[model samples]
Target: MPKGVYKLPEIKNEPIKSYAPGSPERQALKQKLVELSKGGLDVPMIIDGKEIRTGNLSDIRPPHDHQHLLGHYHQGDKTHVQMAIDAALKAKPAWEAMHWESRAAIFLKAAELIAGPYRYDFNAVTMTGQSKNAFQAEIDAVCELVDFYRFNVRNMYELYGMQPNSAPGIWNRTVWRPLEGFVFALTPFNFTSIAANLGGAPALMGNTVVWKPSKTAVYPAHLIMKVLKEAGLPDGVINLVYVGGKEAADVIFNHREFAGLHFTGSTGVFNGMWKTIAGNMDKYKSYPRIVGETGGKDYVFADVTADAKQVATALTRGAFEYQGQKCSAASRAYIPATLWDGVKKYMESDLKSIRMGVPEDFTNFVNAVIDEESFNKLAKAIDDAKKSPDAEVVMGGNCDKSKGYFIEPTVILAKKPDYITMREELFGPVLTVYIYDPEKLDETLDILDSSTDYALTGAIFSTDRVNIEKMTSRLTHTAGNFYINDKPTGAVVDQQPFGGGRASGTNDKAGSVFNLLRWVSPQTIKETFVPATDYMYPNFLED
Candidate 1:
C-alpha cells in the first residue's frame, strides 16, 4: 500500500440465498445446527488481544428452548471495561497511521470469508441461538452482514477522496482522522447484521472500539470476531467485553477518553446515556459523538383503493417476521373502513397458515421472542389487551412458556385510533389494527403522527397515485424509511440505507457514507507554494 490514489471494484449487495426444502444450503445448515447442538461454545472476554476468563459466567440458551444449554460466556467487571478502554487507546496510533488501502483490504477479506467459508457457521448460530428461522438467518447473518462490510469500505474510500477545494495561491486538503479516543458499541440481540455493523463500521474507519454486545446474541457475535481475526485484523484494535449495563456505563461514560457511543437499543437506555454524557461533558477532552438507533412504533397505512392481498401480506410478514423483533416492524396498521373486512379476512387466513415452532424446523415461519423478560412483557400486553373494552384479540393470543418463550402471532382490533397498544412499542409479534373512515384520511394521518414519539420506518398502500402523492407530502416527517408499496421491515443496505429520526435515532443512515462520517474528525490543511516572510501587506505600507 502506497500514498497514491486507489480504486476498489464496484460494490454490490450480497444476494440472499433461500434455503428452500431440499436445497444445498438447507442441507448444509441443518448439518451445522446438529453439530453445534452436540456441544456449546465457551465464550471469553478479549482485552488487549488476550482472552480473560473471568470466574463469573453466564449461561447462553436459545429463546425457543430455555432448557437446552447452548454455551457460557465469561462475565466482566467494571475493571475489565476500563482495561478495554486503555487497550483501545494504546492501539490507536498504529491503527490510525496504517495506510487506508491496508485497512480496506482487511474488511474486504472479512466480507469474503463471511460470504463463502464461514457462511454456514454464522447462519446456524443465528438460527439456533437467536431463534430465527433459516431464511431469517440468511437475510441477517449472511447477506446483510456482508453488505455492511462491502459498502462501509466503499464509503470510507469516497469520504477520504473528498479533499477540500483550494485557492490559486494555496493548496488545501482535508484529512479524515479517527476520533480522539475510543468508541463504545452497544448492540441489540435481534439482528446479527446490526451487531456486526455497530462496531465494525467504526473500526473500518481507523477508530478502535470497545464492543459490548447483547448477552442473548453472544453466539453469533463471537463468530463475527473470529472472522475479523482470520481476515488479518490486528489485535487490541477492537476489544470485546461482556458486562452488565450499569457496570459498563459506570466506567465508560465517566472516562475522560470516551469519544463516541455507537448504539442500537431501547429509547429509554439511549436517552439516559445521552443525559449522562451531557452531564459529564467537562471531564472529556472533546465532545463525544452520540449516534444511536432506538425504539420504533412503525406502521402501515392502507387506503380504500389499495389491494387487499398486498395489505394482508404486508401485515403478516412485516408484523411477524423474526417474531416482530425488528425496529422497523409494523406494530400498528391503519386500514380504510370499506376494506377492513377483506384485509382482516386475509390477515386471519395468513396467521392460520403460518407455522410456529423452533427454528431448527425450516417449515416454521415464526419463532420465539428473545428472552424471558421480553416474553413476559409481551404476554402481559396481550392479556391486558384481551381484557380491555377498546381492543379485541382477532386471532392467535395463545401463549405457553412451559417449554419455550413462544407467543402466538396475535392481532388486536382497536375500536379507537389512539389505543394504548398502538402508541407504545411492545417488541413482539402483537399488532394492532384500527380502521379509519375513508373520508377521514387526513385525520388518521394526524393520529398516527401523534400516537407515538418514534418516527422510524413506515409504509403506505394505495392504487390511486393522487392519494399516494398526498400522503407522501402530508406525512413527510412521519417516517425516515417510507415505502410506497412494500413492507417496512426489509430495508436493503445500498438501496434503502436504513435508519430513522426523532425518537428512533439520530437519522445517521447506516450501511451508507453518512455513517462512516461519524467516526472521523476532519482536519483541514493549507499549504503555500512560496514562503512569505513579510508581516505587513504592500498596500497598507504605501497607504
Candidate 2:
C-alpha cells in the first residue's frame, strides 16, 4: 500500500437513488424538451420530415457507485445514421439559405438554457454518469458548455467582419461557410461538455450534425439533446445517436453525403478513421473535413525553484481529477534533484488528504473510474510500473472493484527519465515523478519533449523569465496547450484553446475561437464596380 505524509479527510458515503425515465426528474426533462421544442413533439430521429426509431435499446449506468441505473436510451444503428444524414441532407439547403443571425440565435438560446434550470440535470447526469465530483462536473457540463457556445458565437461574428481588400475597384471578402453535408460528432466519455461543443459548434455554423456520444456518457448526451430541443433548435439540426463505434464509423465513412468529422478520443481510433477517410476520398461527394483531439501524455514540470506545496496541490487535482481520465490529465512530472525529496514529501502528505468516494458526497475529491474495464487497465498499469526495473511505486497501487470501479490515487518515482511510466499515456490517477539535475534544464526539456508521442498539454514552474521564455519557445511543438506556473489540467474554455499536434490529433483547439474555424469553410466572394464578364482579368491582361 502507498503511504501518505498527511491524513486525508474521511469521506462520508451516501446512497443515491436510481434515476428512471418518466419519473419526476424525467418529467422535468420532458417538460424542458417540450419548452425547447416550442410544442413540437420530441422526435427521436428526424429524417426527411419523418420521425424514425431503430427500436434498439441500451442501459446507461452511473459510474460513481454503479448501483444506480441512469436510464435506457435508444441505441441507433447504421439505419439511424443514414436517417440522420438524410435529415441533415434535407435540412442543409434551407438552413444554409437562412440568414446567419437566425442560425446564431439557436445557439445563443442554447447557451442561455444551459445556464438556467437545465444546469441542474446537466450537472446531475455528469456527476452520476461520468463519476465527476460536483465542482468538476459543474465546470464541464455547465460552465464549459456555456463558454463554448458563447465564445464560438462571439468569435464567429468577428470572423464575419474580417475581410482583406484586393484592388481599388475590386474587393475580395472571405466568408466562412459550413460544409455542404452533415458533420459527424464522435465524442469521448471523459467530458460531457464535449458533446455540446462538438455538436453545437457545427449546428451553430449552419451545418446539421449526427452526434455519437460514448456509451458511458449516453444519458448526459441525451439530456444535452433535451436542452437543445428545449432551446428551440429546429428538427434535423442536431441528431443524437447512442450506438457502437463500428456501426457509426460504417455509416460515417461509407456515406457519400458525410461532409466532416469532429472527433475526440484515442489516437489509434483517430488514425484508423484517417485511413478510412483517406481510402474513401475518391468516393466522397465532397472533400470531407476531419478535426480530432486525441491522446495526451500531459505533464507538469517542477524545478528546484518551484513551490513544493503548490506543486503538490496541483498534482493532487491534475493527476486524480476525474480519476485522471481526461486527455489533459497530468500523467508525468519532472522534479529537479535538489527539490525531489521535499516535493515527494509534500506529495505524500497531500495524498493523505485526498478523499475518495462517490460523487454526490461533495467532500470526496476522487470518485470511481469510469467502469470495470478502466479500473482493470489502471490497476494493471500501476502493477506494471511497480514491476518495472527503473521505477518504484512510492504510493497507491491497489484496486477495490468489488464495490465499484475504484483505485487508490497512485504515484510512481522514476529512477530515470526514460522509465516506461514517464513514456506512456496512463489515463488514470497515476503520477510518475522523475528527478533530474536543475542545471541540465535544456536537456530536461528535450527529454520531456521526446518522452511521449502525444503533445496535448504540458506545464513548467520557474521564476526565471529567460528560462521560462526559452523553455516555452523550444517546447512549442511539445504540446498544443502549454502552461507556466500552473497545472496542465483544468483548462478554461474562453482563455485556453485545447487540442494538440502530432499523434495527439488535430491542432484545432477546442475552447476558444480556433475551434469554431473547424466547422466553417472559407469562401472568397469578389465584387467589382464594373461588370467584367470576360474570363481574363486586368491582372492577367497587359494594362
Candidate 3:
C-alpha cells in the first residue's frame, strides 16, 4: 500500500437482508411494485392506450455480492420499439397541448415523493443493485434525482420563453414545444439519477420517452416508474425496458419513429450508436437528436504549492469512491516533480488507512464493484499496468472473487505522463500518478489533452493565482466539468452543469436549462390580427 494514505472505514460482516421481499419497511415498496406489475402503472410498448408486452424477458441481478436477484424485466424487441413510437405519436398531441404548469407540477410531486418515504427504498436498491456504499448510493438515488427534478422545473420555463412580439397594428408570438416523435434513453448502471434525468427530463418537456435502463439497475428503475405513477404522471408518458446492448441498438437504429437518443456509457458503445444513427439517417422520420455522455479519463493535477493533505484526500477519495466506477472518477494524477516524493508519502499513508468491506455497514467506506465482469476488467488492467517497465503498483492490486467482486484500492506510480496506464479509463479502484516539471505546465496540459479521446472532467490544484489562471484558461478545452480546489466527483445540480464535450459527449450540460432544452423543439408560430385586404399595393396605388 502507498505510504501515508488513510485507510477507509471498516464494515461489519453479516448476512444481507432483502428490503423488498417481506420486511415491514418494504410493505410500501412491495405494494408499489405489485401495483406496477399488475397494470396499476403502465409498462413499456404501449401505443395509443394499449399495453403491448413482448414475450422476451430477462433476469436482472443486484450486484451486492452478485447473489441477490432483483427481478426480471421485459426485453423490448422491434415490435415493442415500434409500439413505443406509436404510443408517443398517440400521446404527443394531448400531452404537449396541456399547460406547461401542469406538467411541471407532476415533476415537482415526483421530487417530493422521492424525498419522502420512498427515499430509503431508492437508497437501498442503489446500494445493493449498483454495489455502492450508503453515502454514494444516497447521493445517486436520492439527492441528485430530487435536485434534477426541482432544477428542471425552473429550467423548462426559462428555456421556453413566453414573450409576445408587437409591430405597427400587428402581433406575433413564438412557442417552444416537444419533438414530434419518440425519444429513446439508454442509461448506464453507475448512476440511478441518470435514469430519471434522461427519461423524466424529456417526458416533462412534453416528449414521451422509451427508456432502456441497465440490467444491473432494474430495481431502481422500476421504483422510479412507481414514484412517477404515484405522483400522477399519465400512462404512456414514459416507458421502461430492460435489455442488452444489441437489443437496444436494434430498436434505436431501425425504428423510423425514433426521433433522438440520450445515452451514457462506454466510448465503444457511444461511437457505435453514432455510426448506426448516421447510417440510418435516411430512414428516420425526422432528423434525430443525439445526446450522449460517454467514457472519461479524468485527471487531478497536484502542484508543489498544493496542500498535501487536501490533495491526498481528493486523489484517494476520487479514485476509490464507488469502486472508481463513475464517469468523472479521477483515474490519473499529475504531480510536480519537486513535490512528488512528499505527495507519494502522503498518499501511501492515507491509502494504508482506508478500510473496505460490504455495503450495509455505515462505517464501510468502500464496497465491491458492480459485477464480476467489471472486476475482471479491472484485474486485467492492473496486470497490464504492473507489467509496464515505467510503472509500479504502489498499493492494492489484489482481487478476491470467491464471494464478491472485491478489488483492493490501488495506486500506481508512473515514470511518464504518457504511460498507457495514465491514458485509459480504468473505471475501478485504481489510479495512476505521474511526475512532471512545474515549469512545463503547458507541455503537461498538451500531453493530457492529446492523451485520450475523452474530454469529460479534469481538475488542477495550485495556490498560485497566475498558475491557476494560466492552467484554467489553457485546459479549458480539455474537460467539461473543471475544478480548482475540489475533486471531479460530487457534482451538485444547480451549481455545476454536468456532461462533457468532444469525444466524451455532445456537450449538452445535464442539470441545467440547456439539458432541458434538448428535449424540446422550438417552433415559431405567427398570427396576424387582421387579414390582408389587398394582394397588390403598388407605389402608384398607395394612398
Candidate 4:
C-alpha cells in the first residue's frame, strides 16, 4: 500500500464536440459509422474476463433500418447468470481489499480512453444500434459518459475524505466499506451513459458486479466491456452477461450473497423487481440496496407570460429528440388558453422543418423508435386520439413501418385535462398538450401535479417572477428535477444530479455522491488512547 495521502485529478465536464458539416469530428464520425455499418460483430457473454458463447443467438438490427443487421449476441440462460454471480462473489474479497486509488485510476483511464481513442467508435455504435442522431449520440454516448466517469472519481475522493471529528482522548473514524456481497446492475437500452454508470458506479466503490445490459443495447454494451477490459479492470470484478431478464433475476435475487441492485428502466419492471427482492429477503444475508431511476411522464407547463416560441422550441426538442425514448422526455404539456394559438403556430412551423430518417444522415432531426413494440404503441395512441372527441391530432401523427419503425413527431391537442394521451407514458415521438384557463392558474397547477404517478422531471415557464415562485412552491413534490423557463430534458452531470421519487425511483440522484453512498456500508471505528479500570462513571461513584 502507498504511504502518502492521495488527491485525484481535477474533474471537469467533457466538452461536447459539435459534429457540424466539414468539421473533423464529423469526418471521423462518418468514417466510423461507415466502418461499423459494413459488418456485424459476434458478441459473447464476458465472465471472469473470458468470452463465453452459447449457440443460442439473437440478431442485433438497427432500429432505423430493420433489414440491416448490425451484429448477433450470444444469449445466455440461467446457468450463465449463475456463473456470473459466482465470478462476482469469488472476486469480491480481492477487489474490496484493493487500494481505493488503484480502482480510481482504472476508471479514470477508461474515461480517457473513451474521450480520446474510442470516442467516434462509441458514438457510431450508439447512433446506428440505438437509432440516435449524431448529436444525441455525442451527448449521451461520449460526453455524458466521459463526465460520469471523471465526476464519479472526484465524488469518490471527496466521499473518502469525509471523516468524523476526533475527541480529545479518542480517535474516531469511519470506513466506507463495500457491501458484503456483490452488486447486480440491470441497465436500460435508452442511454449508453446510464448503462455504464449503472455497473461502473458500484464497481468503482470496491464492489464486484454482475452486469446485465438490455438485449437491444448489447451492441454498444459489448464495446463498453471491451473498454473496461482494455483499461485494466480486473477479471471477475465486473462480469458482463447477456441473459434473459427473468432467468437473471431468478438467479440473482434468490442468491444468499446478493447485496445490492443498481437499475434504470420502466416503473412497472422496477416495481416487480422490488417485489421479488422483498419476497427473497429471508434468503439473503443482508437487505439488498435497491437504487433505480424509473419511468416519467415528464411535462412542460407554460404560463401566460411565457414566450410562445420558447415553449414551442422546448416541446419540439424535448419531445422529439431520441424519438422520445428518454425517461424524462416531455410527453405532456399544459399551455395557457391565452397563449395557445401562438404556441400552436410556432410548434407547427418547427415540426414542419424537421426531417425524419436514419441517423446516418447528418441533417435528419429525427429517427425511428427503438423497435416494433414502441412504434405500434405510438401508432395506437395516435389512432385513439383521432377517434376521441376529447383529443385532436394537431401536428405530426403519421406512422410508417414499411421501411423502418418510423413514427412522425406527433402533437395531440387535448380538450380535457384527463385525456388518455395526456396521462399515459407512450414512449415515442408523441407530445400531448392541454390548454387551460389562465384565470385558474392554481387549479391548472393542481391538474398538472396530479395527472400522472411519475415525479421525475418537469418544467415551468414564466416571465413573471412571482408566478414562477408560486408555481415552484405549489408543484414542489410534482417533480424531482424541476426546470425554470427552460425545457425539462438535457440534464447535465454535476450540474443536475438526476433521479426522482414516488413511482419514478428512490430519488437516489445519479452523477453525485448520493448515488455512490448507496453502494457502500460505512463502519464507524472508535479507539481510546487511555484505558479505564472501572465500568462505572465518576458521577455514579460520587452519588
Error of 1 at 359 (Å): 0.5
TM-score for each predicted model, relative to the true structure: 0.98, 0.88, 0.88, 0.99
lDDT by residue for model 1 (445-478), tens? 9999899999999999999999999999988887
lDDT of 2 by residue, 347-416 (tens): 7887788899887666688898998888888888888877888889998887888767888999998999
Model 4's TM-score against the true structure: 0.99
Q: Of the candidates numbered 1 and 2, which has the greater TM-score value?
A: 1
lDDT per residue for candidate 4 within 343-404, as digits (tens), equals 99999999889999999999999999999988888899999999998999989889999888
Off by over 4 Å in 3: 1-59, 74-76, 162-165, 530-543
**What lDDT score goes with residue 54 in model 1?**
89
lDDT of 4 at 263: 95
Number of the top-ranking candidate, with TM-score as the measure: 4
Model 3 lDDT tens row, 217-239: 76687788888888878877787
User: lDDT of each model, Cα atoms only?
Assistant: 0.92, 0.78, 0.78, 0.92
Error of 4 at 416 (Å): 0.5
Better of 3 and 4 by TM-score: 4
